[model samples]
Target: MPLSEFDIIARYFAQATPGREDVVLGIGDDAALIDPPAGQQLVVAIDTLVAGVHFPLETDPYDIGWKALAVNLSDLAAMGAQPAWLTLALTLEHNDDDWLAAFSRGLADLAGEYGIQLVGGDTTRGPLTVTVQVAGYLPPGQALTRKGATPGDEIWVSGTLGDAALGLRIAQGQLQADDSVKATLCRRLNRPEPRLALGIALRDVASSCIDISDGLLADLGHLCAAADCGASLHCADLPLSSAARELMSADSGLGDLPLTGGDDYELCFTAAASRHGAIQSLATQLDCPLSCIGLVEAENDIHCHDPDGQIRNISGHGYRHFNESN
Candidate 1:
């Protein structure tokens, strides 16, 4: 007989990891309890991904589960927060044992890697949707934020941009994807590694930080608005993987993905030029790539510096909830 849902929770989800004493209630409990460290504040974020909406229907169950949790972790990473506990609200149109097994394994792998505990949640019948609510804790006065950037701060992004966007294009068959670039870009899109350690290292160093769920320019613009600053990004300085650029050079429409595509989940942040050396060392230790893409400017005039210092306008090219215009 297949294991019952509750037994599955007890066997897998309830086991405690080392250094995770704060999860007072897990699995069977009506609600999980998290006792955060004293003098620390908790940060929270929630995200939802809908099947056939946010993801292609053919998307792998393992990747779906991994991404659901990873995107939430990226939010915590943005705040330089240590992951605490999570609650899931899962809806399934139909139940399949094999599918659940793969999804569970994927979620467990990522949770174990990050020391995050799965506490309590609701499982119900509906159109496929997964909602994750994550909590993280950070020391007072040191949590990173979007509003801390100043005009003189340097803008930086970790990891290659536009791969996920390109991956989507390939997945949709809008573009033919072959060769090493296709394989690399598809992998990046399928499995994005949230820069949690990078976020921790960036605490007190970066003036502002946000994970790139929206396009880089759009997400960075959010930071600018929150920080009351503007940005001037050099096109040459924006970090693009050879895979992404090569793919894009073949098709110009894909170029907008970096400015408009969503789902890369890398960190977009700003720090003072003085801290670049330290941040560089940290990025190296973490084995994460960090690139200086631009600089914060005085106000809302975002100057995209291409050759000849021309100010290119990248307007309305970001992810929007009601963005049916595309």
Candidate 2:
């Protein structure tokens, strides 16, 4: 017997919808009904992943599912929001039961971890693509934004950089790594963690925050543009995992990769210089490494500085979906 669209939804996607108090009506209904929590503003974001573009076409279905949701979660995290609901729009050329099951499991696992309930979604027969729109809640006037940084604010970032970009290189045969390092890097690339707790903690502490989806330079540029300011970033201060450091050590040319690499999903934020101690304490409390990499200044261009204060030229303003690359 051939599986129908209704059958696929009931068997796989329906189970992925976890119970939530906010969801008055979920799957199987014509539409989902959600009740917003009192005294909070909604934070909504949507992201789409297309096979062979955002990810490799042959990637595992499970990882693809996790990543599709994770990227959207990252956007919420950047805004200091708590994820409450999600809706998926999946397009595929064919209905493969095993693939759908595994994908649902992957999506459910992460959604459950974040307390996100899948309220509703759509499925279609087409090229494989996943689009997720996530809604989160945060106190009114407390949500972080790109427009908050001020001159003299300390710029900081959570976790390491360049691992996912390196992973992409390795996956595309542009670079090679040992089995262990490759595994670790690939996991970083496919299964990014959204820094929700950290975002909430920084809600009142940081002046501005953004999750690094595009390369550091590009995303920081966005933040800076929004704040109508510039930043002075030290090349030596970029946080890097041991693996990334090792890779860069082997080839000095790779040093810029961390600065320009994207998909890190780490929070890059700015706060007042006086809040340095508080930020350090928060980092310790969260057990997530946070580094102060630079200072926001009253200028319009991001100035990349070497340790000795010499300006360094950078290339490519990060990845653009519609821009052709040389």
Candidate 3:
């Protein structure tokens, strides 16, 4: 027998992603209601998490819920939008009330902390999947885009790179790590925080911006393509977090993983050199450090510096749904 709509709601969708004022209507309704503040342009982005493809089958449901919304939030961050509302579409392999409860709890906690509203959603039985659409608002003419980067613009990135990728490696037992470190990296892999505040602060000043949902080299190629330019990135300047550095040092095989591995969600953006100080100030204000990793050169080609003096070229990536594999 099929599950009833209300049963699905109570079992899985109720309070899916917490509450906010903009959630004019929630679950159990024909449609969701949301209101963007006056004078703000709305920006929207959608992402999907597929079980056994996007995430492993043994993954925690709570972390899955957290990541589902977090990835969508990162899209808004790329556009420099303030999050407003979200709509979810969840498909379950089987209705498990315990799994549903945990998922809703995690989703709600993250949304509430971010002040984003869970306006509405639908649920059904199928191959496990979570699709989230997030809406955000920005003042007139203030959203960011990839096409703004230009030759001679400076490139910057927030936080460390590759930890999440490393986390996945650890989770899959491809890399051996102690329990404490393993837990930490896996958490980063599963529950990414979107860089929304830094994005908003950079809107007017940033030349172009994108979240690093893909690996750094690939995502940078995207910005370069949009701005009709190229860049030679400095390998030394890559802001590998302490955790990632330790993991890489422990395993020689992990050298290029940071450059090609996706799921970091940090913002890789560019701005004029003159705005460096302001960018620094904004970073301080947002409580997230920004690193000057490279300069935007002319559209010659996409190059990432090789620490061993062996240069490597990289291509474009944002998210490719059709690929079905990262």
| Candidate number with the higher lDDT (1 or 2) | 2
Please write out the lDDT profile of model 2 over residues 134-203, one tens digit for every residue.
9999999999999889999999999998999998888888887889888888899999998999999999
Q: What is the lDDT of residue 324 in candidate 1?
A: 81
Number of backbone-clashing residue pairs for each candidate, in the order shown: 0, 0, 1
- TM of each candidate vs. truth: 0.93, 0.98, 0.93
lDDT of 3 by residue, 1-326 (tens): 75675787766556555576666777767897776688889899999899977888899989998999999999999999998788889988887778887888778878988877777778877999999998889999888999988788899999888889889888787888878778878988999999988888888889899998878878888888887889878877888877788888987777776677789999999999999899898878888979998899985677778778667644434345667555
Residue 120, candidate 3: Cα error in Å is 1.5
Runs of candidate 3 with Cα error greater than 4 angstroms are: 1-3, 16-19, 307-310, 313-326
Q: Write the per-residue lDDT of candidate 1 for residues 92-190, one digit (tens) a residue.
A: 776677777777777777878988887887777789998988888899888888888888899999998888988887888888866687788877877
- Best-fitting candidate, measured by TM-score? 2
How well does candidate 1 score on lDDT at residue 74? 96
Residue 123's lDDT within candidate 1 is 78
- Candidate with maximal lDDT: 2
Task: Quantify all predictions' global Cα lDDT against the true fold.
Answer: 0.83, 0.90, 0.83
Flag the better candidate by lDDT, 2 or 3: 2
CA displacement after TM-score superposition, residue 133 of candidate 1 (Å): 1.2
